[model samples]
Target: MLYDLNIAWSPSTSAAELERTLRFSAALGYNVVALNHTITPPVPPQVANPLPKFPPSPAGPASSSSTTPDQTPNKQPKLPTVLHRATLVLNDPSAYHRLPQLGSSYDVVAVRPTTEREFQGACLNLNLTDASLISLDLAQRFPFHFRPKPCMAAVNRGLRFEVCYAQGLSSSVPGDAANDARARAAFIGNVVELVRATRGRGIVISSGARGALALRAPADVVNLLALWGLGSEKGMEGLGVLPRGVVVNEGIKRSGFRGVVDIVGTAEREKGEREDKAVGKGKAAAGEAAKEKQEKGVDNNDKNGNGENKRKIGEEEDGGGGGPEGDDNKPMSKRQAKKMKAAIRKAQNAEAKTT
Candidate 1:
């Protein structure tokens, strides 16, 4: 499905206006669209720049009856899926600290760098950020240039560079023709530079359209991207695939554990698992200790039996209880007999002294 990843949505924009924009996007065959709320650094309190909340049903009427089989009365008109996303314009380095807080609430988070310093910070610090659209529309006012190192770094980190086509498309407003022409030129130049720097690897084409008139069909966007130096395959990927990747990665960042593991089971279930594991371990330990005690008792019994056997053998040999054979059996070795006689004499002498 085609995805238009950026559409300016703000607190100031009425629900009717947003509905009109989304209807047009759906009509143009975009399957998914991001409602972009742009926040400027040094955020003003008056502006309620909260993330867009998706409504249960689309703003307009449901699909009406049609003669075509696909559009029958029973069939429902499919409105483009809405996603809540935010774009932060970085004017100060310290302002970046607020992104994590804002990112948690939004489906997708993007950064627009207004200065060289901001651009560097975006590339370095926003490695985990969703996207950073080259603010080429602001090139007429700012002297920021797209550098390669940081751009490639961001690409390696799964951060994409957005090329917004809304401002670059032809404008017939008589007073704004010159400004629009300059914007188109700068946008084309900046986009070309980005494609070359990233080797056409991590670029996404988006409408960045505020209204229906600015939105284009997915085919038109793909063709426009092709004209801007990306291969046809890359163009298609920008519209259909890369934008989905942004949504997926941003979703992981929002819901997953430090973007590493997804949390699916409930807390109660997790606690139960831990308790079960502890109980099992305790049982195993108790069983092991009991087995060891049983084995130790058996060993002690064996040792006591061995001592009794030795005592019986000693009594038979020395206390006239008889040897293993017969009393008549004596040591054949003279030395053994002599040693036995000496031991007997020593015992007799001790008895006499005691008496």
Candidate 2:
């Protein structure tokens, strides 16, 4: 499925606008989209997700049951699978101590590092914070260049770098053309450096669009990234594979065992146990049938009153007896008798010769 990991969201954003953007995204072929709420330092002690939940879109799995005739008439177009995401603006390392707590409140957790030190820390030390995406505002020129060591380090740790194309897109505001041009240039330059540093891997492209107007189709987004020096394959990956990985990784961090093992549900466990019991019973029945068949054969043989029958069965079992009556009265073979007669003749001749 196509994924857009970052769609700008805030308290000031109207529900109508968000819904419109989501619908537009779905129309553009994004199966899943995350609404990103940017949070700054000094996080509140009581972390709660403020993003409002919307009803499942008509195209969603639950839509068949959730939508009714009355609601269908007024229902809007289907929206993509919407997920709540929180992006912590990491200015100081100390500000991110409650990252795990924040993660519990959001479906996905990301970090936007402002300084070189913060960027490096986010890349190398993200495991401690339980953050998945390293979102950089590539529109602004950074003092430090994207180095391979730290970028690859993050990739190795299963972390993704987010490049928001919305930052480079021209705004609707008048007299902002110069700023837009500069931002676009900076975005292109930074993207080239990032693609180089990470060797075109572990990069996720997101719209980061605040409104419907800013979002682009998946194909357009891929082409845009490809023009920015990223390969077409990698660009497609950014929109699909990498972003999906981020969402899935964050989900595991919440629901799985230390993000390594997932606990199976009780129903699933019970089902497996039932299947095993069935197999065991089948094996037991087969074994019992074989044993009973062997015993029945023995009983049938025992039913015979004549001792001859028993003797015949024993001889068959013993691979044919020496004689029908008994082994003691069995006659010797012609070859054995011939050998015995030859020995006697040789002995007589020797005695006579010695005499």
Candidate 3:
């Protein structure tokens, strides 16, 4: 089953409490949902997430008086979904053994560790030491230990890896032609090298979306993959969805399931669009405020200059008009020279910053 991995990063989700979201995701096209441990365990019926999320579907027995079927703690989705034991599962000993057992019920298990040094140990425990892939962070601002050759050779020969470059904190598509090209180029260059160097190992695109409006549709990811020179077929293969991953429910209708997932994402997108408008409005207000402040400062300076001019006129009235002219050969007054130099420096700095 296909699953979104940024579940933990999204608006509200817990490894044990995300049953409803899983149900909805399964109801959509995904066979599984990725969970991150970095996000704290969500609070009660309400939780912390970037996006606003509905509760997980009911796992317990249905009650006639219940308002919705999503009131329970861990209702199983119609299909099998994977629970990634990344940061969360690794911390709790309870999850260490329990997560791997899902392999019996579903396909595509994940293995995460406490440290890079613990990789082998964790992999061995999860029975994935020689398993196929590794998920890497894309929005990482700092450098990471990024060698895949050793992992490729050691993990398994002819193993295919999925590169999950998700949009975590940043939601910007570059603004200009040059900037956009520069940004996309770096991303493509890195992945292309990995795909080429690693040979059998490749990449898969995931939303890594969470919070209020972080998700992008799987189909959108498919389109994004094509832009990177890989098609959906290759991406799915890399994601272990086609050949390696298994479906949890056998009799479910594939078409209907995928349809529901699309709808949920569409809803999330609609909300995001509205939220984006609100953010844009806030920015506009802030810009207007800044402009007003600048104008007021300029006006105040003008008033000060007027006062200075009036004081000079009063001095001339009090004392007889007496003047001494200096020749150009004399050194310029320090005050006059410094003022001119300051103006030039201000202009130069402004120009430099714009570029």
Ranking by TM-score: 2, 1, 3
User: Residues 192-271, candidate 2, lDDT per residue (tens digit)?
Assistant: 99999999999999999989999898888888888868899999999888887777777777778888787866644588
Kindly provide the TM-score of model 3 when superposed on the true structure, using C-alpha atoms.
0.39
How do all models score by TM-score?
A: 0.64, 0.77, 0.39
Please report the TM-score between candidate 1 and the true structure.
0.64
Model 2, position 322, has a per-residue lDDT of 43
Enumerate residue pairs that collide in model 1. Answer: none
Model 3: lDDT to the true structure: 0.46
**Global local distance difference test of model 2:** 0.81
lDDT tens digits, residue span 294-327, model 1? 9999999999999988876564455433233435
> Pairs clashing in candidate 2?
none
Off by over 4 Å in 1: 44-52, 56-77, 127-142, 170-174, 264-355
Which predicted model would earn the best TM-score?
A: 2
Per-residue alpha-carbon lDDT of candidate 3 for residues 199-257, written as tens digits (9 for 90 to 100): 43345445554432444556766666666567667766644453233222111112235
lDDT score for residue 303 of model 1: 100
